[model samples]
Target: MTGLIMNERDIVVPGEKIASGMDYLPGNGTFREGEDIYSSQLGLVGVNGRFVKVIPLTGKYTPREGDIVVGKVVDVGFGMWNVDIGSAYSAILNMRETSEFIDRGADLSHYYDFNDVVIAQVTKVVRYKDVNLTMKGQGLRKVKGGKIIDVTPSKVPRIIGKQGSMIKMIKEGTGCNIVVGQNGKVWIKGERIEDEVKATEVILKIEQESHTQGLTDTIKNILEGKGK
Candidate 1:
């Protein structure tokens, strides 16, 4: 019965019907018809037992409250910084949220300059989609001593894997500390230069083959080969 339909991780297009009957339920990126499930966007199919879902292959990150994101400072102004988070609108990080003491006349560049990468959390998102970011939290600050990279925002989950098992493997294997932002910015830091490069390769590979099955083992082998 299962083999009659599209396999897991198969790329699907919009309005393409993939499954039928009451045995399967539609999940993300899919919608239910009379007795069939159809893909609502370009994505990869996911069949975990009886639950059917679609993993989006391409999309931008939409801001949401409490979303931790890595952003680049693109512009600086009066008491605020504009961040590019790969979205239509740039997120705003105000100095008030950055420190307890902020003088109105003080130069903001002393804290964050143009092109500085920052890991921040979306404290508030207005109806107009203006994202307010804050760094006053544990492990949220300017990125230093690490390599920053970008990936498709939609692929972040696959990079994270089930219960964060995938990323954990990459970290343990490469001996790198990794921070993943839901906005698709990743910061990797390793004790050794070679380890950081290895970790970066693993991350990019995972992003490329995120829909493939058995990816965990595949990534492990790549990391091991680099270690040797």
Candidate 2:
């Protein structure tokens, strides 16, 4: 008989057992255990049919199409902006994807000066792995008066929780507007600078501890303490 050692979303650290037995199958990050199997490392458990794989919950940013990300305007060209999306591959935001009626000869600097932060959407992913971004729709623009924090891209889903529940709780408790970039950059704005700082600290703490059980409850406790 084979048995699964862990369930989906269960965090396992290095040398942790994942599964056992031969009749039953194993998923990712699993190895045959002389008719049994086990897992290795700190990651979330994901089971697909007879296969079980461990999805690492903490890692660097990986580009994906249609991911809304926060980026800095690094260089402006005749009709495009080079954005640093915290990856080896930089992204391009063409003028056509910007605001309409952009003056043909307007100084791009006036629109997006170097080092300016902006919210953008990944429009296309090239064969070379380069990302194309755009900022021409609602809720996409230069961010002002906020501090940015970096977190593991893989931990974003946990921070957001199911259907935006986790983040909403944080915002309601801290009275801060939090924007999580798919590329792992988080922008937080609050009524006061201290509030913003506290919010960032809370978010970072959540990110660091998301692999643990009862994360939502833990975050709630933190928020409640902050609220008081």
Candidate 3:
């Protein structure tokens, strides 16, 4: 038989027992030993029927294939660009994936230079955690005239909310264009500088208080000018 020993949303530590029995299966941030399940990281417990998982509260961002992320150009090289995507390793964006072709002796810096920000996707992850990035898909491009911010990767889902409802609220409320990256980077742009600042504050708030209940309501109140 299997049973959950911890309540959903409760914080758990590594090696702490979360469930027991073969009937239960471990999900992310959890592992199984015999009929027992234990936490593999510090995170909140989540139980769905026979499946139990943990949502991490703090950790470095891990790159995943097909994940869209915001990145900063760290260096422009001969035929490749190095991007800082908030990971343990920098990601590589090659000229072939960036465009069809360019002159052999062209200045790559003209295309992407140091300190420029962009929205990209992870196309491959090789051994030793080397990441490859691409920006050819829809809505992926260089980000100009916007402020970029950071948030914990684990809190990104909550910042997005159910079907992007939360982010939609912030955009509609402040008239800001926001792009959230899976690597914990956010880019915000608005007509008024104040709107952009407010939106950033709101996102940071959500990042900090994602585990708290009624967070949507709180954010709604903040956006409506009804709360601080």
Clashes of each: 0, 9, 0
* Least well predicted 10-residue stretch by lDDT in candidate 1: 1-10
Estimate the TM-score for candidate 3. 0.87
Error of 1 at 119 (Å): 0.4
Give the per-residue lDDT of model 2 (tens digit) for 1-228: 457767777878866777776655766566666776666646788887777777766655667888999999999988889999887788999988986668788888888889999999998987626789989777998988788899988788888889999889889888998999988999899999878987888889888887689988888887787678
Give all candidates' CA lDDT scores: 0.87, 0.82, 0.90
**Between prediction 1 and prediction 3, which has the larger lDDT?**
3
RMSD for each model, in Å, please?
A: 4.3, 4.2, 2.7
Which candidate has the top score in lDDT? Answer: 3
Output the number of the TM-score-best candidate. 3
Rank by TM-score, highest first: 3, 2, 1
TM-score of 2: 0.79
lDDT score, residue 137, model 3? 91
Estimate the TM-score of every prediction: 0.78, 0.79, 0.87
Give the alpha carbon lDDT tens digit for every residue of 1-228 in model 1: 333277787889999888888888888788888888889989889998877888877887877899899989999999899999887799999988894577888988888999998999999988727889998999888877788888999888889989999999999998898999999989999999888898888999999887678998898888787677
